[model samples]
Target chain A: SAVISQKPSRDICQRGTSLTIQCQVDSQVTMMFWYRQQPGQSLTLIATANQGSEATYESGFVIDKFPISRPNLTFSTLTVSNMSPEDSSIYLCSVEGQGAEQYFGPGTRLTVT
Target chain B: GESVGLHLPTLSVQEGDNSIINCAYSNSASDYFIWYKQESGKGPQFIIDIRSNMDKRQGQRVTVLLNKTVKHLSLQIAATQPGDSAVYFCAEIVLTGGGNKLTFGTGTQLKVEL
Candidate 1:
């Protein structure tokens, strides 16, 4: 498993504002992903952060809303743009381990007011 | 499995008793499955995983059983403890342009009663 950490563990942002969440891993990894967990809901994958390239987003997600930047293999950032109350959710980052299993970060709890 | 309501399915178990959580997946071609536990204010933690070719897999005190015919899987925890109180989720891996993505179930909230 990999040691992953996220910055600004919890934040409250006003609607129409943007917040950037950073994820750092202890070691280099090829596959890093961002997920969203809504209140009282299970997780939903947002995008995959590809090192040195544009992130691959899932259906119903766009780069404009949730832009991702992976400058290196060990770090990535996800920015939620033009936040709304519906965007209030826990954002988590995870990395793929050796056996295809994933290790997750502590998660960033964001509340859009 | 899947639920349409806003609330999650919950299971209450006594401490030291056995607990079972069940899930039903959608994709029949999905070859990989994983179980995760999420505590309040924390990310999901990997518990155990199994493949389509296997029926059962075991971890420290947890066991995973898969039934391909019914597209169902289950997690069994022995001697449940207070620390085990959390939400459990089952996920299926599907091939995607971004690689394999996990599709999660509705999740079951496990409440361990002392």
Candidate 2:
């Protein structure tokens, strides 16, 4: 199992502001991903953070809105740009562990007001 | 265009009894499936995973069963404990050019009553 951690476990920000959440893993991983969990909803994949390359985002998501940076194998950052009330959700960082099982960090809960 | 969905939104089970949560997927190309448990205010935690080549896989007290013919999946927890109460989600891994992406299903809330 891999140990993962996220910065600013939670934060409340004003609308139109941006917040960057950081995710760190204890060891190097080949695949790291950012996910969002809306209120009472299942997890949605936002983007796949690639080391030294631009992140691969899913449909309906764009880099302008959610920018991701994977500087190394053990660290990544996801920024929620121009936040809105709808963007108020838990942001999670996960690393694909052994046998395709993904291990997640304690998500960063963001509340936009 | 593809989706993973659960048959039930909520399940209530008595402690020490067996519990089963069901899921259905629309993508037949998906070859890997995983079960996750998310407690309130926390991220989804991996419980167990099963590959398409196998019909069943087991962890400590958890078992995952897959029926490819029906595109259905199930997670069975034996002797359900209070800690097992949480929202459970089943996700299918779709292999893409970028990497393996997980499409999660509508979660099922499991309530363990003593």
Q: Which ranges in model 2 have alpha carbons more than 4 Å from their true place?
A: B1-8
Off by over 4 Å in 1: B1-6, B95-98
User: Which consecutive 10 residues in model 1 chain A have the weakest lDDT in total?
Assistant: A95-104
Which candidate's TM-score is highest?
A: 1
Candidate 2 local accuracy as lDDT? 0.89
Location of the lowest summed lDDT over 10 successive residues in candidate 2 chain B:
B1-10
Task: Pull out the clashing pairs in model 2.
Answer: none
Q: What is the C-alpha lDDT profile of model 1 across A29-89, one tens digit per residue?
A: 8889999988889889999888878899989999999999999989999999999999988
Clashes of 1: 0
Please give the distance, in angstroms, between residue A98's alpha carbon in candidate 1 and its true position after superposition. Answer: 1.4
* TM-score for each of the candidates: 0.95, 0.94
TM-score of chain B of 2: 0.91
